[model samples]
Target: MPVQRPFNFSAGPATLPEPVLQQVAAEMLDWGGSGMSVMEMSHRGKEFISIYEQAEADLRELLAVPANFRILFMQGGGLGENAIVPLNLSRGGKVDVAVTGSWSRKSAAEARRYADVQVVAEGSGRNIPGSANTWSLRSDAAYVHVCTNETIDGVEFHELPRIDNGVPLVIDCSSHLLSRPIDWSRVGLAFGGAQKNIGPAGLTLVFVRDDLLGHALDICPSAFNYKTVADNQSMFNTPPTFAIYVAGLVFQWVKQFTYAGLQGLAAMEQRNIDKAALLYTTLDASSLYENRVEADCRSRMNVPFYLKDDALNERFLAEAKAAGLLQLKGHKSVGGMRASIYNAMPLEGVQALVNFLKEFEARHG
Candidate 1:
C-alpha cells in the first residue's frame, strides 16, 4: 500500500486525488484483465486507444468543448508547449503575448524564436493596466497568447480579454484548468499541462479549433504539428498512454462530484471559488500574513503570500509541515509561501491549513 501522505500544496506535480491514486495503484499490474499494465501496453493497442478516447470524450463532456475543436493529448509540459504553440501557429508572422507573470514572459520569449513576438501588455505589479482597446495589436499577428493565471504572482484573468483584431486567442491555463468554466467562445486554443488540474506530469491537453489546424510553418517539427497530431488522433508518436488513462479516471471523478446542488465541473468550480475565498479571507484578516495579489484578480488555485516578518519563513514552513500541511513554501522567485489548492484539494484541507495558520500566529506572535 502506498503510504498515506498529508495534504500537499506543491505548485506543479502537486497532490493528486486519493481515489485516483488508489485506482492507478490497483490497476498497475493488470488493467481490467487486459493482462498488461497500462504502462506496459503499446500506445497503438486497442486498450490504450480506448483509454485515450474515453479520456477525451469525458473531458469534452465535462468542459462542454465544442465539436469543432480537436482535443489533442500530446506529450510535453507547459514549457515545451511554449515553443510548440508558436511553431504550429505563428507561421513566421507576428504574435502578441501578454506578459502578466513568469509563464507568459517565457511564452513570449519562446515565440520570439519563431515569430515577431510583441508584448501587447506587460505587468510589473499584481495586475495589468489599460483595456484591450488600447493594446497595439498587430493586424498580421497569427494568434494572441495570454497566461490566464499567473501561478507565481497570484494574478488571474477572471475574464478573457476582448480583442478587436480578428486574431485567435490562445491561453496558457496550466495551473487553473478545470477549476472553472472556460469561455470557449473567446478562446480559439487553450493548452494546459496535466499535472496541475488534470493528471500526471508527462501529458499535455491541447484544445485547438478546427480552423487553426494546418497552419504550421515548414520549420515546425512533424511531431509537434497540430494538424499532424490531430490527423493521427494524437498517436503520430506514442502518446502518454498511462497519463491519459489516469486523466480519464480523474475526469470521471470530476463528473460525479457535487456541490451546493450543482454537479460536475460547475460544482467543482464553485467549490474552488469558495475554498479560495475562505483562505484569502483568513489571510486578509490576519495581521502577520499578506497576499499581494489584487483582490479583483486573485487566483483561485495558487495563493502566494508573505509573512509580515520574513524572519519567520522557515518556522512557518516547518510548523506547517508538522501540522499536516506540506509544500507551503512559495516559489523561490517570489520568496514567501504558496498554497496551491488544485481540484484535488478538498475544503477540509484548506480549513485545516487555515486553522493551523491561526494557531501558529497566536503562539508565535
Candidate 2:
C-alpha cells in the first residue's frame, strides 16, 4: 500500500479529490478497456473526444453555466490568460482592472502590454474595494477585469462588481472556480487554471459569452483566439488530453458529492464554507496567529495567516510537516504561512490543522 499522504495546502497545482485520483490511477494503464492510457490516446480519437465532451458537459451542469456561454478548455494557466484575455477581448481599446490584490495587479500589468489598461479601483493589498461604485471605468472600455479570488492575499469577492456601462466583466477565477456557483448574468468571461479546483496544471477552463468570441486583436495568435477554439470545440489544436481526462473524473466525483443534505455544487459550497470557517475561527481565536483579510472578503479556498511571533516560522513549518500538514508556508512575497483549503480539502483536514495550531500555540505561548 502507498504511504498515507499528508494534507496538502499548496496555492496552485493543489490537492485534488481523492476519488478522482484513485480513478485516474486505476485507469492509467487501460482506460475503459481501450488498451491505452488517456495520455496515450490521440486528441482527435473518438475515445478522447468523448472524454472531452463529457468533461465540458459535466462542468457546465455542475456550474449551471448559461446556454449563451461557450466553455473552452485551452492551454495557458491564469497568467497566460492574463495576456490572452486582453488580446482577445480588449481589441486594443481601454480595459478597466480592479486591483484587489497580487493576482489582479498582475492581470492589470499584463493587459497593459496589449491594451491601454487602467486601474479603475485599488485596494490596500489586504482587502477588496468596498464597492464597485468606487471604480472609475471609462464608457469606452472594452471590458473590466477582476480576479475574483486572490490566492496569495487570501481575499475573495463574495459578490462580483457590477459594470453598468455595458462593459463586459471578465474575471480571473483561477483559485476559486468551482468552489461555488457563479453568477453568469454579471459575468462575460471567467477563466481559471484547473490545478486548483479542478484537476491538473496544463488545462485552462474559459467560459465566454457568445458575444465576446469573435473580437480578438489582430496580434492575437490563431490558437489562442476564442472564436477559433470555440468553433472547433476547443480542438483548434491538440487539447490537454490527460488533464482533461482527470478533470472529467473530478467532475464526475463532484457531481456525486454529498454533504449536510446538499448535493453537487451545493454540497461543495457548503463543505468549503464549513472548512474555511473552521480554520478561520481557529486562527481568529488564537493570539499566536492572525488572518488580516477582512472577514467579509475572506476566501473560502485560500487562507493566508501570519504567526504573531515571526521567528517561529521555521519551527511551525517543521512541526506542521511532522503533524502531516504539508505546504502550509505562505507565498514568498507574503512571508508567513498559507493554508489553501480548496474544495478537495475536507473538514477533517481543517480540524486536524486546527488541532495542530492549538497544540503548537499552547506549547510555545
Candidate 3:
C-alpha cells in the first residue's frame, strides 16, 4: 500500500498526480533499460530526442492546437517571458495591455521598457473590467496582451476578448494552461510557465501562430528569438531535459484521465468545475469565511478566501497544518487564505478541505 501524503494546496511548485510521481520514482534509476537515467541522457542523442518529440506531439493533441501554430518548449519562467515576449513581438513600436490583476500588470510594466505600452483597460483589482468595448486599443499596436488567469488575485477570463482590429492576442496562461480546452481561433500567441498546471518550473511553453514569427527586434537576443528557436525545433540550446520529460509524462496521464463518464481534457474541466463549486458554495454559506473576488470572474484554479475575524489567521493556519492540509496561506500582496485546486488535485482533497473549513469554524465560532 502507498503511504498517505498531505493534500498540498500551494499556488505553484504544487502537488503532482500520485501516479505520475510513482512513475517518475520507478524510472528514476534506468529509463527503458538504456542503463542511464533520463537526466543523464544527452539531449542530442536519440533517447532524449524521442522524449522531446512525443511530449510536443502529446501536448499539441491534448490542447487541440492548430497546424498554423508552432509549439516551442523554451526556458525562462513567466516573468522572463515578460521581457522576451515584447522583444520578439513588440517590433519596438506600440503595444496594448489590459491590466486585470497582478500578473497582467507585471506584463504591462515589462513591455514598457521595450515598446510604448498603452493601458487599454484597467480592472478594479477585485474584479475584471466590464467589457472589451471600453478598451482604448491602438490601431498601430503590435500585439494586445492579457493574463487569462491571475494566480495571485484569483480572477479568470471565462470568455476571451474579441479584437476586431488587426492586433494579435497574447495571453499569459501560466496558472491554468490545461484545465480546459482553448479556442485556438481567438488566440494569436499563448505562453505559460510549466510549473502551475503542466509540470515543474524552468520550462516555459509557447504556442505561436506562424504569421507572428520572425519579428524579433534587433535588440532581441539571438537565443531568445522565437523564429530561431522554432526553426531549430526547440533545441537551439539544450532544453530543460528533466522538466520536459516529466511534463510529457503528465500529458500522457491527462490523456488517460476519466471523471463522471467524461474523458481526457473534458473530464479534467468538469472535475475542476465541481471542485470549485464545492469550495465556493461552502464559503458563500458560511459567516466565518468569504471569497472576495466577484462571483462571475472568480478563478476555478485558485480560490482566495478570508476569515471574518482577522485574529483567527494564525490559529487557522496552525490548525489546518495539524489536520494535514498544507499551504493554505494566501499571497502576501493579498492577505487571506488561498486553495489552489489545479488538474492534479483530486476531488477527495477538496472535500477534505471543505470538511476542515466547517470543523475549524465550529471550534472557533
Candidate 4:
C-alpha cells in the first residue's frame, strides 16, 4: 500500500483532494457495474460518454461559463495550446502578448511561427503597472494574450486588463484556474491544464467565445480546430476519459465545499485566499526564508521562496519530507523552494507548512 502524506506543494502534476482520489480508487476495479475499469473502457462507450457529459456540465456550472463560450476537453497541455491558440486565432495577423515570465515568453515565441507576435507589455506579471498607458497594443493585432499568473515567478494579475481596440483577450490561466472566480467579461478565451487545481495530468480545458469559432489556419490540425472540437463536443479525437472523470469528481467536491457559510467555488476561493495568506505571511515574517515577489502581484496558488542560506536547500527538502510535506522545491529555471497551495489544499495544510517552516527556522537559527 502507498503511504499517505500531507502538505504537498507541487507545481503541476500536483496534489489531488483525498476524497476524489478515494472515489477513483474504489471505482477502479468495476465502474458502476460495467465490470470494466474506466481506463479500459472505450472512449466512445456509454460509460465514458456519461463521464464526459457530467464533467462538462459540472465544469460549466462551476465556472458559471456563459452560453456563448464552448468548453473543449483537449489533450495537449498548456505548451501545446501555445501553438494552438495562435493557429486558430492569429489569422496570420499581428499577435500581441504581455511578456510577464517564462510561460508567456514561450507563448510569444511559438506564436511567431504563425503570426507577427508583438510584446505589448513586458515585466514580471506580479506588479501593478507603473502606468497603464505603457502598453502599445496594435489595432490590427489578432488578439492580446496574457499569462494572468506566472507560476514560476509567483506574480498574479488580480484584475484582467480591458482593451478597447476590439481585439479579443486570450489568457493562459493554466496555473491559477478555479482558485478564484474569473471576470469572463474581459476575457475572450482561456485555457488551463487539469494538473493543478482541477484533477490529474492529461486533461486540458479550453473555453472560447462563440463568435471566435471556425477560424483555423490551413496548417492547423482538424482535431485541434476550435470549431471542429467544440462542434463535436470534444469528440474530434478520443478524450482523456479517466482524467475527465476525476476532474468531474473534483467539481462535485468543490460544489459541496463549505467555508465561512459559502459553498462551491466561492467557498473554495475564500479558503484558497486564506491558505495563501497564511503561508505568505509566515514566510514574510521569517528572516531565514523569503519570497521576493511583489506583494500586490503575488500568486495565490504557487509561492516560490528561498532560504537566506542556499546551502540549506537539501536539508530543507529532507526535513520537509520527513515532516509530511512534499514537493516544496521550486522550478529549475528559478531554483529555490515553491509551495503550490491550489484549491485542493486546505487551510490546515498551510498551517502545517507554516509550523514546519517555523520549526526549521528555529532549529537553524
TM-score each candidate. Answer: 0.98, 0.99, 0.99, 0.97
Candidate 3 TM-score, C-alpha based: 0.99
lDDT of 1: 0.91
Off by over 4 Å in 2: 1-3
lDDT of 2 by residue, 28-143 (tens): 99999999999999999999999999999999999999999999999999999999999899989899999999999999999999899899889977888768776788999999
Q: Which residue pairs does candidate 2 place in steric collision?
A: none
Whole-model Cα lDDT per candidate?
Answer: 0.91, 0.93, 0.93, 0.90
Off by over 4 Å in 4: 1-4, 125-133
Better of 1 and 4 by TM-score: 1
CA shift at 273, candidate 4, in angstroms?
0.7
Q: Give one clash count per candidate, in the order shown.
A: 0, 0, 0, 0
Q: Ranking under TM-score, best-scoring first?
A: 3, 2, 1, 4
Indicate the residue-level lDDT of 167 in model 2: 93
Prediction RMSDs, each to the true structure: 1.5, 1.0, 0.8, 1.6
Candidate 1's error at 274, in angstroms?
0.5
- Model 3 spans with C-alpha error above 4 angstroms: none
Q: Locate the minimum summed-lDDT window of 10 residues in model 1.
A: 124-133
